[model samples]
Target: MALSWDDEPTTAAPAAAAGNPEASAADVAKRVNADDKRIINAKTDVNQLVPFKYKWAWDKYLAGCANHWMPQEVNMQRDIELWKNPNGLTED
Candidate 1:
């Protein structure tokens, strides 16, 4: 596909870009205070990871790590040997 411009380009007067009133009004106090922070539409810095506002999230992460398991930690050698043996099972 090809695009063709039949009319000449024209320039219009530049307009000021609108800014968010809440974001523009943000101050250092808002960034430091976690009480005013929220999951969405927060006036504070969302990029900041330090000074955890929700302790429950951190606690849940720690608790979840306790049950972490991997296939490498399990012993499957006996199961594999039994599966490979022809006499281990009948026709069924």
Candidate 2:
């Protein structure tokens, strides 16, 4: 049977009160790995998993890596932009 969104595994809820921050990281990592496997096995497409509100943002992210664009090119562009404007603030 297919899994529903609620059936997806997740990290344990954060402690009701703050105590140990590093304590839960391992448990959280295991949960994340399991959830990732579930997603990969399902072969769900990005448009289906991502919410409509954020789909455009996801599309833009994908577009940057599409075609012949490589990680180094993307990083270089970002570095150049940063160097041009050190105070990386945009009017958003």
lDDT to native, each model: 0.61, 0.60
Candidate 2, 10-40: lDDT as tens digits:
6956653346656665555653344444553
TM-score per prediction, in order, is 0.30, 0.24
Model 1 stretches with alpha carbons more than 4 Å out: 1-58, 89-92
Which clashing pairs does model 2 show? none
Ten residues in sequence with the least summed lDDT for candidate 1: 27-36
User: 1-92 in candidate 1: lDDT tens per residue?
Assistant: 22236646667433433465554355323445453334544456665755666899778767786789787889989888888998876677
Name the lDDT value of residue 69 in candidate 2. 60
Model 2 whole-model lDDT (C-alpha atoms):
0.60
Q: Which ten residues in a row are the worst by lDDT in model 2?
A: 31-40
Q: 58, model 1: CA deviation in Å? A: 4.1
